[model samples]
Target: MMQTFLDLKAKQPEDLPSIIKIAFGLAAFFPPVKSEIRLDFFDDQLNEVQKEAVSFALEATDLALIHGPPGTGKTQTLIEIIRQLAARDLKILVCGPSNISVDNIADKLGPFRIPMVRIGHPARLLPSVISTSLDVAIKYSSGGMLVNDIRKEMDEKLNTSKKTRNGTERRKLWEDIRDLRKECKVRERRCTEDIVRASKVVLSTLHGAGGRDIIRQNFDVVIIDEAGQALEAQSLIPLVRGPSKCILAGDHLQLPPTIPRTDKTSSLRKLELSLFERIIKLHGPLIKRTLSVQYRMHEMIMKYPSIGLYDSLLLADVSVRSHLLSDLPNVIKTDETQEPLVFWDTNPHGGFGEDDTGAHESKSNAMEAALCRYHLRNLLEAGVQPKDIAIITPYNAQVALLSGLIKSEFPDEFSEIEIGSVDGFQGREKEAILLSLVRSNEKKEVGFLADERRLNGICLLQNSHFLGTVP
Candidate 1:
């Protein structure tokens, strides 16, 4: 996969520089339509900022960046843009770094009644969107009835062969069954190709797009969600499929592409800076537009990232600022003012230890895990739904420790509550969050705890509290 990316990069028109130049050009690539752009498909009106980005995307010929911070309605904006592009009779390739991200966009597009197909492992996708799976694509494109008929014949022959007593008849039945199965395989491939060629919108993970069935396909526009979390090479894989315009939506300040530690100075590691990060750093926002209005975080939760990371560019929407956990239990609040943020100091003495995987993972603090259980019980007792609370930590070992602790102690309490590492918790949210900052040591030699991006993941919540520290 890395070699394919390198080969594609080498063959790229001007090694990405030329593409950037073409993408950033102000020339109007999309011809003006006879009628003005209308966003009737949206249930609600697009905010002014969102509307501007849509207009820019429709008019721009080259590359475009939709700087969607958490809760900024990035997926909604992309859906709108996709509809408008389709209205122009253009094909779109919607892709992302991971299956989860791609499935999310595909899921949202599901409601729009669009002609789309999601190409990847069906198990990774939601059942609602699985109808657009590659299998379904083949069925639809090649005629579902034909595929079903072939499958039905194969099934009938197998059942008959099972019932057959005569060796000669049974052998003949198995041969017919094998032929039918072969025919089914042949039809499936043809149907898949047909769907790929006919799809107005194609959804796929970056790697999934490299399939031979789609190699010859190109698109009028390409939209990549969560671009910041994708390695540069992974991002290039889908873009190689013909896309005249590219739309990248993600917050680069939150999480970066995951690079293997062993490849620290390797050529592969150097490509760790995501395409979104590279563009924004080099271009300095000339080709990017920050989606300033975020509706996810409370005023307090949005504070750190807004001022420290986003240059105070982020503003909590009115609804978000006004939202309060009115039913929050007194035990969870840090003060009488009822502010949801808390920094529960366990002052644990535990330090880092190498796990079986040999990674230096943070040792779980018993005090912190116990406190988390206490808080979760209090929240539930106060009428908070189990699903509304999320327990976030910075280490997988800590996640395991906390999860085990929760199950053993509470048994059935807050079973829906999520407990995972910060990286796994990206692109997710909860009404109230209980973060276990598991680093408790007298020396305060923070390991991955010092990473600002991982810390930013903490800020992605709506109303949250952090307990414990490296004291």
Candidate 2:
């Protein structure tokens, strides 16, 4: 990828596109050149703000940003933008930081019947998305039939090589097998290029966009989801591909790029700031729009972060404002279980405190783990399905302890319950969430919880019920 950028940088200034020049800071400031084309709306259910975001994306000539907080239907809005862009006969390139993120956009694009293909290794993709991958597309193409025949011959030769006792015969079979494998590669490359050329939309992770197969293909527009979670260099791999327009959608307030603790160098620290965040800070409202309505969390559960993190701009949709676990037909709710927000305080003076005695310096509190288990049992016995609940903690030690405790306490019914750290649960949500804050000590340190982005993410990870264990 670095080589690709170096080659791009070596090109003459007049040969590069405007977007690439803007990305490299070689272009002067220019106002957005709005296109006057009429856009067709595929999904009429979009809110006013969502509709505005789509309109801005289609109109902007150089760049656009969609600031989507948690549960604001960012993916839905991006889908609409792609649909509209496709209707205009524009070739689109959609990307994200991870395979799952790209797969999510591909899955949602299925119903629209768009000519789309995902590029990545099959092992990294979800099972549901493999059918739409470039490999699968090649397998079903006319060129793929030739590749398959060559592969079958290679396999037959391999079998013969293994069975033969004579060294000369085995050597001959191995040579033939090697030649057939080379032929397969040549044919597969042709198939890949053909499939990519025929598709209108290409989906991939940020790094996957730099693959040798599709690196030469030009796109009219590039849309990257979860942009704030990717490093600036990673995002630039797709942005420098000569697209006339680029749209980035993500929440700077959620999670930033994950940098290893050992990467303490000044250069690496600067790289931790994502392109989405840097652009937003520099441009602000000039090229950005925020989606204010969220349909995931209940109003009460969203109130704190909406006020503190989002300047009270985030709102709960009417359908989910009063939603609760007790509203379910079979749920047996007590006073504690009925509220949207519940705190179970474990006061250290009362003998419940965190300790790292057996956790290798990772904090763990036995009392908090037990309390999490008790709440899990109550939610399960009250008719909440195990699949609908998630156990979240700030420390891996606490996660391991909670998982062991739950498995032992409910040996037969603990398989579906999800237990993970906050980082692992960044883009996930559940009907009910149980959070364990496992830092209670003499100095009153909160560790990583002091990062406001982590706290903002935890506060918005639930739909109806939130049970937090504070020390």
Q: How do the residues 77-183 of candidate 1 rate in per-residue lDDT, one tens digit apiece?
A: 88899988888889999889888898888888887777888898778888888998987666555366688999898888899989989999999998998888898
Error of 1 at 412 (Å): 2.6
Instruction: Give lDDT tens digits, candidate 2, residues 1-471.
Output: 696578677889877777666555566435466567665688989999999888888888788889999899999999999998998899999999989889999999988889989899888888888888998988888898889999999988999889999999988898998899888998888888888988999999999899877787899999999998988888888876678899999988887888765535546667768888887666566768899999988899999889998899998999889989998778887875589899887878766788756423667899889988988988988898888899999888889999899999988778899999998898798999999998877778786688888889899888899999777
* Candidate 1 TM-score to native: 0.84
Residue 282 error for model 2, in Å? 1.2
Residue 152 displacement in candidate 1 (angstroms): 5.6
Q: Candidate 2 at 345: error in angstroms?
A: 2.5
Q: What is the lDDT of residue 145 in candidate 1?
A: 65
lDDT winner among the candidates?
2
Weakest lDDT window of 10 consecutive positions for candidate 2? 22-31
